[model samples]
Target: MRIVVVGGGMAGTIFANNLARRLSSELKAGKARITMLSASDKHIYQPGWLYVALGRMTPDELEREEASLLEPEIAFFVDPVQSFRLGESHVVTRSGKVHEYDLLVIATGSRPVPEDVPGLKENSVHCYSAEDALKLHDRLQAFTGGRILVTVGLPHKCPMIPLEITFTMHDFIRDRGLIDKTEFYYTYPIGRAHSLENVATWASGEFAKLGVRQETFFNLKEVDGAKGCVRSEEGSEVKYDLLVAVPPHRGEAVIEENKLGPNGWIPTDRYSLHMQGDHGEKVIVLGDTTNLPISKAGSTAHFEAEVAAENAAAMVKTGRAARSYDGKVFCFIEAGKDRATYAMFTYQKPPEPRAPNAAMHAFKMAYNQLYWASVRGLM
Candidate 1:
């Protein structure tokens, strides 16, 4: 059996590592093969981008060479995938290299579509990538005082990121004694300002306490970067001195070009994570590639990857169905400099995510240090 994994982000790399380890005996016996195709050598710790934007961490600290983390036992390719021949279960690389596979795992994360909205590309400083985070870090570092606007576009990865940025900006400004000089503004298209209803209720109060005014159902439509103003689809408008927003998200061209989802995202069985192509060929997607209607945070990716890996391995080894993910997700929210909060839940709803505190902050700091080891299954 040949299993090919695409996109070497957290989901792809870790799933490949764990899957290969679980099938060690078959691997040694030459009964199965595992191969990973990564676009570049750089493997970034994505969640750390938030800390980067906060000026608490640097971009260099969040990146690692993807090849460095993959077990030597798995075949590695430094090939960027162009698209898939779904019917024949094959992938074509950018350089026209064709590879066939019995099972495919796609972990291609989403991309921010600033182009999706007119004038958006010229307006906000997005903190989704390493460079973007570093840019935001510099902007935040140099900012003296004024209204800081943070808005969230739809279908963003790490849905908690803008929230973390909003809260962290408050602390950042406060540390410089500019908190009083600056007013923080936030807006979301969602009704409660967050995905989980109850959590939104609690967080809204926290935002109020911190003097961060929030608006719901305000979908970004146009940006007037010159005037530091934004107009929402609902006709609401906000003006600020600095604008930071997560643009609308869409899946990469690999799936999008193939007519995968309603809007470039590949739709999968919510429980199984298996995507059925037009020819009835199925591929398992573990991360942002799928339109799962859940938070596209790293935690969701981690859990989905584990579940998908188990199922893929079983399908190859024993023709058995694996366990369901049950929509389990975990998230840590940093409310300020020394404190943070956490939430853990399943499909239906979440617990009241922990209130911000020093312990949670310390926990996050420790996790950052141990992330590589954890993903490599060494800790």
Candidate 2:
């Protein structure tokens, strides 16, 4: 049997690695093969990039070669996927190479769609992608002090990241003695400060203490780069000196063209991570590309990979039913002045039901080290 895993992000890498390790015996027997496809040769630790933008971490610390993370035995395809033919049991690469597989796992992840909003692509600086974060970091370093606007475009990855950016900027400016000159504004389309009501209340309080203005329920409509202004769908306008925006997210076109999810995301059972397609039995999906109600964050991807690996291994062994994936997510919310908070939750259950404290911050820091160690097999 041959398994093809697409988009080697956190979820894909972990799932592929886990499956390969568990099926090593089968692999050695020439009974199974595993392949990993990635668009880039480098594997980026996305969560660390956020800290890199804030100057707390360096870019080099967040990136690792794709080969370093994968098992040496798994086949690696460094090319963009052009399309997926579910019925044909094959995937066509951008170079026109077709790969046949008995089982396929889609962890293609999500991309920032700045063009989804009018004028955003041409006007704003998006900080979600690694490239965007680097650009934003340069811009932030040159900025003296002005009305800085941080806004969430819509349906972004790591939902609380923008808020962390805002808080971190506040601390950065305050440390520079430019607090009075810097006017920080945070805007979101969500009705509340954060997604969860309990967390929103705590976040609003944090913003208040940090003297950051909050704007909620304001959908970003267009950006006026020349005037440094952002317009909302309700016709309200927000003027800023520097705009840090999170772009709308969408799944890869191949997944969309195949009628995966309503919004280009792959629809899957919350528990099983099985992609609902014509060849549903042979296809599974996880991470930001899925239509799961959970927050689109790295932790969710990591957690989902655990289940996907078990299910894939089971399918190869006894042909047993796949286990369901419970929605689990953990997030670190930056408070101001070297302080931070963290939260963890599951489906329909709120994250800790409150704001995180210093202990949570310590946990957050430890988690980063622990995660990297796990990836390196040192943990």
Candidate 3:
């Protein structure tokens, strides 16, 4: 059986690795083949990028060679997916190569849709991708003072990232002895500081203590690049010397073109990770591309991979129902100044108690090391 995994981000990589290792015997016997398709050779440790942006870690520390993470027998394709033809059970790459598979896994991840907002595509500097993180880092290093506006676009990935950047900038500026010269403003489209109510309450107190101004219900309408300001739907404007924006996110184009969902995301049985459209148990999806209620985070992807791998293996062996996925999400909200907070929850409940301290910061650091080692098959 041939298995083609699309989009080699955290979810794809973890799913492929788990599936390959579990079915190694079948793979060696020529009964199973696993292939991973990605658009870039680099597999960035995205969670680490937040620390890198804060100068806590270097760019080298946040990057890993994608080849090192895959099993030796698995094939790797470094190319963009042009589209997916579900009826034909094949995927066409940007270079016109067609891949046929008995089982398909969609983990292509999401991309920043800066074009969703007028002027944002042309002006704002996004902080979601590796390139954007590096650009923001450079911009931060050179910034001496002035208004620094960190705005959150609609349906952004990693909701806490913009908040973290805001806090980190406050601390960075203070460390540079420019606190008095700089003013920090955080704008979010939501009515609260974060999607999670508990997180918003905790964050509001922290922002108050740190003197970071917060504005809510200020959906970003446009970025006045020429005027160096961001205008909200309410017609209010905030000027800035450096604007770190989080653009709206969307599913991969391949999934979009195939009529996966109205929003381009594939609807899946949350616990099983099975694509809703497939009558058989052949197609599965994970990560940001799914309309999962949980936060689109690295940890969520990791957990989803576990469920998908198990279900995929079971489907191959017996015609049994797949297990359900509980919407459990965990996040480390960086509060800057060598401090952070931990929050976790399931879909029905609110965020759990906040674990605030420097130890949480240390835990975040160690988690990255563990992630790298595990993905490289060293653990």
Best by the lDDT measure: 1
For each predicted model, how many residue pairs clash, with residues at least 3 apart or on different chains? 2, 3, 3
Comparison by lDDT, 1 against 2, better one: 1
Error of 2 at 337 (Å): 2.3
lDDT of 3: 0.80
What's the CA error at residue 7 for candidate 2, in Å?
A: 1.1
Model 2, range 1-379, lDDT digits (tens) per residue? 8999998888888888888888989998989999888898988888877777777777787778888888776899898677888889999898898999998989988888998887788877766766777887888788898889887876888888877888777777787788888888988887888887777888889788878898998888888888879999877899988888888889877777767776679888788788775788888888999898889998899889878888888888989856777688877776756567777888867666545567767777777667765554333
lDDT of model 2 at position 21:
86
Error of 3 at 141 (Å): 2.3
Query: At residue 76, what lDDT does model 1 achieve?
Result: 87
Number of the candidate with higher lDDT, 2 or 3: 2
Worst 10 residues of 1 by lDDT: 274-283
Candidate 1 Cα misplacement greater than 4 A, ranges: 277-282
- Which numbered prediction scores highest in TM-score against the true structure? 1
lDDT of 1 by residue, 1-379 (tens): 8888998988998799888888898899998899898888888898888888877789899888887898877888989788788788899988899989888888888888888888888878988888988888788888888888888788788777767788888888898889888999989887876776766887799888898999889998899877779999999989988889888888886677767776777878888788854643457888888887788888888888888888878877788867988998888877676888888888876567756789989999999979998677554
lDDT for model 1: 0.83
Ranking by TM-score: 1, 2, 3
List pairs with backbone clashes in candidate 1. Answer: 339-357, 340-357
